[model samples]
Target chain A: MPLGDETIVLSRRQAEIGFAILAGLAGFVILFGAMEHDTGWSRSGPEAGYFPFRLGMLLMAASGVILLRVLLQRGPSEPFLSWGAAKKLLAFLLPLIGFVLLIGPVGLYLAGAAYLFVAIGLIGRVPWLKSGLIAVLVPVFLFIAFEYAFKAPLPKGPLGPLFGLI
Target chain B: MVENFTQLMQGFAVSLSAYHIALMMAGVMFGLVVGVMPGLGAPNGVSLLLPLTFTMEPVSAVILLTSMYWGALIGGSTTSILFNIPGEPSSIATTFDGYPMAKRGEATKALTFAFLSSGFGALFGVVVVTLLASSITKFALLFSPVEYFLVFVLAFASFIAFGAGSPLKTIVSILIGLALASVGMDTISGSMRLTYDIPELIRGISFLVVVIGLFGLGELLETMQNPYAAKAVTTRLDWAEVFRSAMIWPRHYASLLRSAIIGCWMGIAPGGPTAASFMSYGIGKRMSRNGANFGKGEPDGLVSAETADQAAGSAAMLPMLALGLPSSATAAVLLGGLLIWGITPGPTLFREKPEFVWGLISSMYLANVVAVIMALATVPLFARMMQVPFSITGPIIAMICVIGAWTVAGAPFDLWLLMVFGVVGFVMKALDYPLAPLVLGMVLGDRMEDAFRQSMLLSGGKFSAFLGSPLAVVISSLIALCILVAVMGAVRRRA
Candidate 1:
């Protein structure tokens, strides 16, 4: 439950470098747009982009300082993400992305049921019958609750008519 | 004052009807389910329900939504006690002590105390709203762009005051949020700033989608991935112990009162419940005779977090009611609901439609009382959920997140944004950056920008006019001091 060493895999320095670079790049992008929109004061005073422009520059400088601090620090460091935690994160998150992608073509209801069955029966290693039942029932419940009770229709794919009773 | 009280009593007459009570109960129950679920929180719950409000009366709609808000805050602590996973960000502090109590086989005691303290806090918040109703109305009616802008600045400054992260990180996070907020077409000039020629990007990033991803999916990804993180399920349901704790809670009156006041101030100031929770708990731990006893299953710590969270959640309505300003994400969604219902929330709301405003204020009290009773009755049912396998629970959460994101705009693009922010949330968490400020920034960012531009236009481009108002001067000075202190502290630590 705690974010302890067990979850830490990357060295502190590596994580710091990665975050700093990302932030610094984002800052540069922001600054670029801000400058293009006229970041300086105008005839009326500060322009639309004026405040954001300064904010972007500050982000870059602050991130640079952060990178420096991490580099210079001599104290002992902890790993950012442990190996086991990394595997778990990827295993859980990657399949979730796949499920989300399938929603467009497969429909939310169909994709959700399939995702549930596979995630529960296969990845979770639960009994097939129970997982199948849950996979079927939850979508049905959501259909009734959302489509009928609330009258807020969810995304319907090709197979949407299969559960139109609700 | 007497007239407002009489009107408030009439408001209560409206709220106490059987039909309204049933709605309140349903709202509370739904809110609890949303809160007990790991992937949903107050903002997500309210936004998801916004669609259903279209057909209902404005009073019933506000009552339902606000009761759900109350239920969500109370339900948030349940998971914190049982699973060491905060159902909402504000309950993160509760996990510090509540989980320890659960581990010690006092799950019912912790739940009882948390629910009761939360109820008390809600009452305190309602009392404040009742007493300050006229004054708040006056303030709202009189406030110019200058006062309102200062209030927004105070909201922005709060992130720094409340954030424990490095000032640079906070600033960077806020800037990113502000930049993201600017992505949609500019409301003022109708000029697109960062849409990148994408049709879907025209609406900019929906705060609802971004939040569902950041808090809901991001949290699911974290604990669901790590099997080792799961603890042995604790399922003690002793009514006697709970009753005893409830009976004894009033003895800790000092902490209860102090935390209530702290929560009220934070809620009013736009500091949000998370900050209030942390601040209240910190103060409780410091002032308690059992200071070192905290984080070791201490009751007072749980009380502090619970009380402050609810107090702040309830009191957060003040700004929304008085000024149409939302202090938190949930409040923002509630404001959105108000707009949808064609009920403009401002000073005139009091004079023009006392029934709507007073009805809402009265229902808040009833909702808190009802939420506590509902929460107590259903604690066993919710506790059973914590024992359910994550395999089943995890997918359900993902489905809910996807459904919530998809339904908000009924746009598939929101699902994509949800996915993107989920990863963004993961990375931010992996790097120890706080997510609350980012959320606050996103919600307050556009408003702050608009306020600034308006102030600029009003001043006719004179930046000094920002300093012309005493209120603005005070708030701006506060922000300056916050940055200066943060910088000085960093330098001192380095030296």
Candidate 2:
């Protein structure tokens, strides 16, 4: 018998099962590490590895329950991960990478402005002129507030001499 | 009695200083601004501004910073009332009734009630911290590593009970957090454990960075990911109407007192403000003439929430100052600040640093008055702060987050770690894992381990060491009960 026209959903249960397996593997790694570090019982007290060993057991136990549940579940088919969300996340990530790369070479002030201008433009789509004004003005203001007024040192670059004028 | 009086009087000596008072006022104003802003929070604000206090006298510096703490507490309600968005976690309950009232044009009434109730709650908490400081510290010192481990266990278990999704995911997230926490130094061996050959990872990760990435960057990413989005909600106020309505009815003093009690009590508990505010709001609804209007933006609802929220913020301080154990994130920052100042809080703090202790208390009273005036005056203006476009504001926040992270150790390595944690934070958020436990674990994990090792040594490795005294026995039993309850609750909820 044909079922009603319902969209097929991805097996959310399967992904959960996958996670359980991964967790079990990680648990073993942790267990191995603790055992290697001398976690055996002693006459007077628990040894150096006692707590971590217990935590590893707890992890394994929880993961076992999760894995069992995941295997027992009957579910529909659907995508486990969403591609659409990843794209949006990447937009921010790219600019963050750029900021990191530029910070040392261009200096904190200029690099900060560049990051701000680009990030704000990408996220808000504000006009370039407005974004530029904000990008340049905000960091400079911070420079004056933190570096000049408070005497807290910031990263110096080629423009370090220029900032000294403040 | 005379000693107590002299100590308090000496505290006033610092608190009553014109300079100290002025600094407190400034802190309150700054806290207000940060609290009302959607993305900014008390910890971020404190960390950002803490550097400025270096040159100020310690008393004045504390006065200012703590006032900012109070200011942020009150300022959070402003946005929660005007917009449904809570500026701080403590104000989440305020949005339930406060926003509904604002939507109906009772913005002024809501704001006014929120302001006054917060003032009352804070003053009440001040009295409690003042009187109960000694006893609380005495109680805290009795907590051994095993007891603290149990407390941490109970706290971590809560994620399974309170978090919205599958317990498996929450545990995974917690493990990840614990793993991350372990990346720095091996306490016993005095060796770098998981630095991955990076000199920066040797210091571990920064809490500020982790939180900012998790809360700020993750949120921004989530908002951008939403395909269908309307323009950000912005509101304009009719100042005259707001003021008129705000003054229409006298406040319920009894309700304020009740909420204050609720705040102080809940602040001491594990749930903190979220529970305190809800409990106060519930009580207000049950005991009000406007009971039927609870969710429709009644002014009384606003007052109930405001009183309890601020009171919780202040009461949360008791554990931090009295016990040297921070009950919440903001309290953690204050604790860290105290450590940096070479001041060890807890039972001995009263005897060793009476000036610091009393000075903090006296400043609270002054900060309350300062914050109230500042909030009332600034509410209308701060409401318009969103006018600053995201391009400008967003980057500024990120910059602050970066700077704040770097300042923790003054290392660029921490900055890199911050970026990584930010990404991890984003993923954890998407997976419905709570970040608080991870943070609590990171903060307390080493201490818990150290205490366990020390107790073992003391007992000559006897397991019975944990159950030696009646106090230890009772605390240990309670911890066992907590775990059993937590596990049972999870199973029931799943069923």
- Pairs of residues at least 3 apart in sequence or in different chains that clash in candidate 1: A7-A82, A8-A81, A8-A82, A9-A81, A9-A82, A10-A81
Model 2: how far is B56 from its true place, Å? Answer: 6.5
Model 2 lDDT tens row, B85-153: 677777887888888877776777777778878888898988888777767767777766655554555
Estimate, for each residue in B279-300, the C-alpha lDDT of model 1 and write its tens digit.
9999999998777889999998
Model 1 regions lying over 4 Å from their true place: A1-9, A34-55, A161-166, B17-19, B51-58, B82-85, B95-106, B227-236, B240-245, B289-292, B295-298, B336-349
Interface RMSD of 2: 3.5
For model 2, residues A52-159, the per-residue Cα lDDT tens digits are: 666667678778887887677676645434555555567677887688777777777788888888888656588888888888898888888778677777786788
Stretches of candidate 2 off by over 4 Å are A1-36, A40-84, B1-6, B50-62, B141-179, B226-251, B286-289
Worst 10 residues of 2 chain B by lDDT: B225-234
**Candidate 1's error at B166, in angstroms?**
1.9
lDDT agreement with native, every candidate: 0.81, 0.70
